[model samples]
Target chain A: MNTSSNDKQITDDLMPQKFSKSGMIWVGILSTICVIGAYAYYRQLRYGLGVTSMRDYVSWGIYISNFVFFVAISLVGSLITAIFRLANVAWSTPLTRIAEIIAVSAITFASLIIIVDMGRPERLYNLFAHGRLQSPIAWDVIVITTYLFISLFLLYVPLLPDLKIMNQQKNKNSAWQNKIYIFLGSFWKGNSEQVKISDKIINILCIMIIPVAFCIHTVTSWLFATTYRPGWDSTNFGAYFISGAFLVGAGGVIVAMYVFRKHYHLEKYITELHFEKMGRIAVMLSLIYLYFNINEYLVPAFKMKKSEAAHLAELFTGEFSIMFWFAIMVGMIIPIFIMLFKKGRKPLPMFITGIMIVVGAWFKRYLIVTPTLLHPFLPMQNVPDNYKHYFPSWEEWAITMGSLAGALLIVTFFVRIFPIIPIHETITEQNEKDHSK
Target chain B: MKKIIQNRYLLLFFVFSSMLFANRSFAQEDAGQEIVKLHYYNSNNSIQYLILESTLKKNKVFTPQKDKTYQIYLDSAGTNLIAKVKTDAAGKGKAFLPPTLKKIWDASPQHTFIVKAGDEEIISDFIITKAKITIDTLNLDGIKSIVATVFKFENNTWTPAKDVEMKVGIQRHGGVLSAGDEETYTTDSTGSVTAEFKKLNLPGNQKGDITLVAKVEENEFFGNLAAQKSVKWGVPTKVDTHFFEQRTLWTTRFKTPYWLLFMAYSIIIGVWGTLIYLVRQVIKIKKLGS
Candidate 1:
């Protein structure tokens, strides 16, 4: 095909399409869940956090676990978009938008879930009005806000060229869709200067986002680590959290990549090669996370200090033993074993592995937050028997699931509104490959 | 049909009679198990009163019999009624000896008190004796001692009440701390017990003043008597009222540590400065396109 025809075909293939019947059903289901979650939040606001099962001892329940999960999953944007771009990995070009949207949506809900966790959501102003600098909570607020903005810019800057392309395809979009394209990208003339400036700023953001992403999760880890609690007082917590975050974030991206590739029939662009590479990365991340898990748990188990003994025992052989082992074996070990083999790196197997990792990682966060809270340094005294254990009430579960559904809805709408794969970059890369050949 | 109706009526009558019989038996047993206690208290100002408590035992539980009335008399023959006491919700009642009993009270050193409830009477008699306690402080060459003496008025003379047991201690809000290792001290033949002060560096008021207390509690003859003496035997404590004003991690938001504030603000400004620049650059991109 001639250059002009080839470019036109790429744009035609990559432009946003209307949702199919299944897609509409998916959206409807997600909207229902979101509505349910909204009602749960309303109940939480109307009554109090008493609606949740959290009490004095197990104050940090699954809501906090969900928050950590969202924060952990958000790190994939940095991994795929910034780290891969800076490393000049050519194959990751098609997956950048998927990772970036996941990061954006997850972080958005991370902030929302925190507000839902608050008993007095109206008192949120206290965080800024009287926030103490010495508090790790204050540090987390600062870093998360900074990371969200940087991730947004990273997502937006790369889309300018694609937005301009979508705007030119006037007959393909509705009137409102065309207006949205204009409002977002009418200023993008795509001249050499604009492209140059966009490239420079994207590079700046790529570097700036790496540390901010690390700080976001590390400071979140500090929120627990700075406490004197048994399961949380390790110096290894920050690196441990960061490694686990990368694993889960990569799992999220891999899952997204597979879903988009199959649903959109972009097998030619996404390719088996992409899955193989991501599988390899997931394996490496899982192994590194496994190493850190050993460092976090094994050393403490060896000494078994009186304070840490009960917490470690609960995780290793006590009430949480089943979940603890599931998170380790399924989240890290089994995925590592699966992806290490060449046959297991296929798209379907990789997808299953990704699901395993994500589910296991969620339970891992729950185990991390709850077991330690149950085994506090002080002896459990005079509290209700229910206070000594934690299980998310229906409201907590609905709200958490709703937040998850809400995040998925955002990504789903984003996919319907914009090309899941970057049209301009894919074309440019294709052109470069053809010229080289 | 008439015989059946008569049999039915007879069965109903028997059931009601049995229920009434059982209820009356239970009431009698409860009344038989009722308990009463009387106590006398003579205050430091020489005013005296008596307290009465009534309770009933049922099913291994003691329940207060509230709103019950008891009559107090100066004799066993139900004559010379001194006062009528009524119980409150706690099953306790209080009454003072009436002015009419003054002559009877002063007529002898021994007196009898009688209390009467419905179908029950209790009598208690005791010898009334007046006693006084005197506490003295001695700091001879820094060997501080608390000496307490007990004297009883007998035969119109004050005589030493030897072998009397009393508690000598430094006074505290909750209770008294023993001046030494022993909890209580016994008086010698001279009616005095000396307790060596052994608490070291005890904190006291700004002037190093500590109140030493000597108490003869619930004595059979003396009722209860106590004396106190002030001594200078503590390390004076001066509180620092300005502690909260200092900048520290535990302080209020306005008093956050300077070093922390500086570090946090520096990091915030540096990071946000870059973000502001990036925002300005994006606006510039929009302008450039325009």
Candidate 2:
């Protein structure tokens, strides 16, 4: 009777809970923002990209930058769930599910924002119907789709046992919850043979995902590096992008772990040790990204080629300087300084640094995309004066914010139905410890 | 419901009343006032000036309600201070333009100047022409540099062209009809200009032949003129002799190695094949309990 009660208590604590009033209000606000964004996008679709401030010179703007940011942050799922698992690291198990969810949501929106960036999004299907395999865009579409499915599988495979557990507590959960669990994972029996097969499948997926993840981000960096633009034309872009991506992704995971821990009151499961480990990881990644940043800028500045000089000047001391400095300090440097200290690795301070890294990384993407485009080799001439400079219009701001809110809403709904922290995995770990003792 | 209907009726009454009063004020502000507007008048014969004569469009348009002071000025690069003229109530004004202004103009001898009155401005143009241009290719021996002698009809006869710039180009013989970049060269005191070109500057026929051309395009002052001569350049035009061997990242042509294509296909097949298999395995698990 005592063992059964303890199991029931564990089940209740790990099960997906109903949304509190605050959660409902948060969802409502996000939905409203999404609706507004949808309306703004509809206007853009009707009127064409002309409604946005993007013109001939600054053809690629916030949309491309946002897409890059999404792709960058999406890399964390592979870093945490796949790489860690393949490395046989045990500490990352509790955080795996959060990382995977972020990857799925971010990549989904990464694909969406790309469609939004296109002038004729209706013709997006044409990429498949009469596509040229030679195009870089075709390559991106292929890899992102592959990465998305792999991410989804990585997310879903782990949730099966949890889904099965949810299906068991017949009376405790609502009818909708029971139906979802059944539809998703009624096949999960938790038998030794089944567990053996599941473990083998997960191990294979974890191994398979590492290269696919690298390919997705490497191809994304090639989209810019292949261009003739001075800032984008560099051998360092792929490694630079990958490193920066890992840093921001780790930052994102830290941010999410803190939120899920505090809000869901899963402090017992997501302990301070996870924060310390993640904080150390974040610092290391920030340092790697910082090195790449130096290589990306320093080598170019040394040459000061006539074409590259203008672009470097713009980033160094001209109009984009403020954003450049902000991104460097808040995104990489400050977080590095803070996370280096033991005291700074505490959850609250790490959360603050995580948010800073994320926000700074977004502007860093902006700095990467827009400033380079503004300094094309040919001088800007014979265009409208407004085309001389770029600032995101109200419609752009609304759509960008809306896309962000939409991603959050996805994570929100995901947590509402599925466990943010993996219940079955936690239980398995607890069982293993007891047996070992 | 009854009170709401009463309030709606009251709102409609005020709305209708306000519109009526608004229309009355709009009509009062209009006041049947007519102002004389300005227009441009073209002059066929003029030597030293561009004329601007304002004409009224409507029958009662030119009220001449007061002095209604008008100003006549040439709009040179928008400086708006070239020259002005006075008109005595006849609404007539003339703007004098410089003959050798050298302001960059379109490919037209006629240039437009403007006249501004109280609220209206009129544009009028006059003809400004340059001396006749004549070009001739000089150096027939050397293919490295082209020397073309140009002369202008000034002071009644042919003279060495001074301060006249012309473009030198080569019409390519290979492939479709196209020309190389036209290098601009200004005539020296001797009216002879030389264009320096690298060896094989323009593509030629199988016999290494190409045509050199010297041209002066129609500018604000000079009408267009061109002269051409044949020259045998260096090597034969490059063909697709080694296209297959030359591999570059930019080209999408299939490589003999077939490695990239094979690798891409393998990754696609392997990843998606494994994915489909995993999904099927998940489905097969449902049969386990049954």
Candidate 3:
């Protein structure tokens, strides 16, 4: 296994391989979760939204928060792949496909989870039919649809040349791989003119995706901000959401980097340098996000308008205090501290920190949506006592976890088919490095 | 020659002017009780009448109701015709339409019959008293301000209408006002004008009575012109009071509810989402430059 293997041999080795024994078990577990989630969704549909622990008082719960988390994580596609390419940062070439696939899968479920949150998903056509221009839900529908198409295109256009490579060099791919490659990119000739057109199109789409990426999360923030509830009624919501989204997205990419590197034996490609750089970026994002959190929570707590005081106190020390403090410490503060050390920026520590940030961010979103609803300006009264408390029903948990597993399964299958690293981009960067030497 | 022409024109104008003045005087003299003035008085003393003109017919009975007790006979049917009246108390059961000696036949030539007290034979012939009762316009003007007047005919005398009932009222048809003899006005001539009118108080559906009457000399004939005059009166009917009461009821029927605020909030959320979507699309397209 010479590290400086010839280009043909390298391409052959790097092409996607079949699942190993653990890979099969992992797929089985994800598939099982997805099936259970689908069954839970069937029960939810049969029993109405009432099947979840949501009610009139806590009208929105884990489903909406999960949707926000998925959308936030999906932003990594733009950051790791598009932003790095536009800046001509060459080291990220190996991780670009992993980020894009993660983005595509997460956003697809982000859209699905939102539909799951809907009371009448059967009338999803109402989004187009009676869709009012003035409504924020309609806006989310329009932008989410646009973002999905753009993300799919972004992932597809770059993979065309690779697909052609796998198709022409059939010795490396199985019968199924050869079929997928031919079905996807048989028309790609890899001529200079086609290459030039593809490059120009990819560049245009990458630049276009940035603002859409920003807008998807910003509008998602406005869903809470526009409400009259004390905790959600903040002008700081949009920027706060955007900053948190970037932090979580960077964390997701780090997690993917470690897992893909260890499992696929791509340690040579995804090296310590990639981890250290991403670790530093993640730490900086966590700090920036911490700044936004302070602005979002502290400034309001200082004023403590009579309407807001009770809600603020509840998060600080009341029933919700545990979750509130937990999300802040784990999601922002701990990650910042962990990644601050030089040794902590290594692959294993960074992976652990990434997992902490991701989990903390999920609960943070839940705290954002659920607590505000519970603390509406009018006191909660006369409703069933159960309405005052929120704990996701098993059905809700199943559906939410299934969506999460579904997103991972898509990433899993994507890696199975396409080379998780962009072979052409990495070879080009490698050639440039050799020439420079 | 011009002065002579002017003098001839002036002479012709003087002749025409003198004839017009003579005609106007003649018209006023002919206009008698046919153009008598009417005023609503609070008491019988206030109802002083200067005799306009009078005409009385012989053996005529002016029975306002099915029961009557007086009768009269006229000597002639023109101005200055004299008439004599008798009462059932005096064993005479007829009355005259106009019972004055100064005028007789010049009054309308219609005869009214007084039925006897024991006249159990119900008369089939009904006389034309009023026709085509049409409500031109029922105005609620002066509804709050109107001092409702009711009247009753007394022994050989008539009292003018007076306010007796104070309660809810409509201006025209019928309403409740003050009721009792104490609320009535007394004339300086020692005439007691006791009136009773129904007082309407609430908003809708009035069911009460207000009867108005002009008192005639009770079964007695009087030659004095002042004694012959009847006091005029008006009272609130049940129908008029109902109209204004119904108006107040509708004013209280229009008040709004609490769920509308939440619906408005949802509409605002829909609008906010739309704007964010549009702004993002515009920015994306600009970045694409396509």
| lDDT leader | 1
**All models, RMSD in angstroms:** 8.1, 15.1, 31.1
Worst 10 residues of 2 chain A by lDDT: A1-10
Per-residue error for B5 in candidate 2, Å, reads: 64
Question: Per-residue lDDT for B238-285 in model 2, tens only?
Answer: 677476565444454444235656777888999899888887766666
lDDT of 3 by residue, A67-116 (tens): 99998998888898789999988788887888889889989999999889
Query: Candidate 2, after superposition: displacement of residue A333 in Å?
Result: 0.5
- The order by descending lDDT is 1, 2, 3
Flag regions of model 2 displaced more than 4 Å: A1-3, B1-257
Top DockQ: which candidate number? 1
> If both were scored by TM-score, which would come out higher, candidate 2 or candidate 3?
2
Candidate 1 clashes between residue pairs 3 or more apart in a chain or in different chains: none
Show model 3 residue runs off by greater than 4 Å: A1-5, B1-290
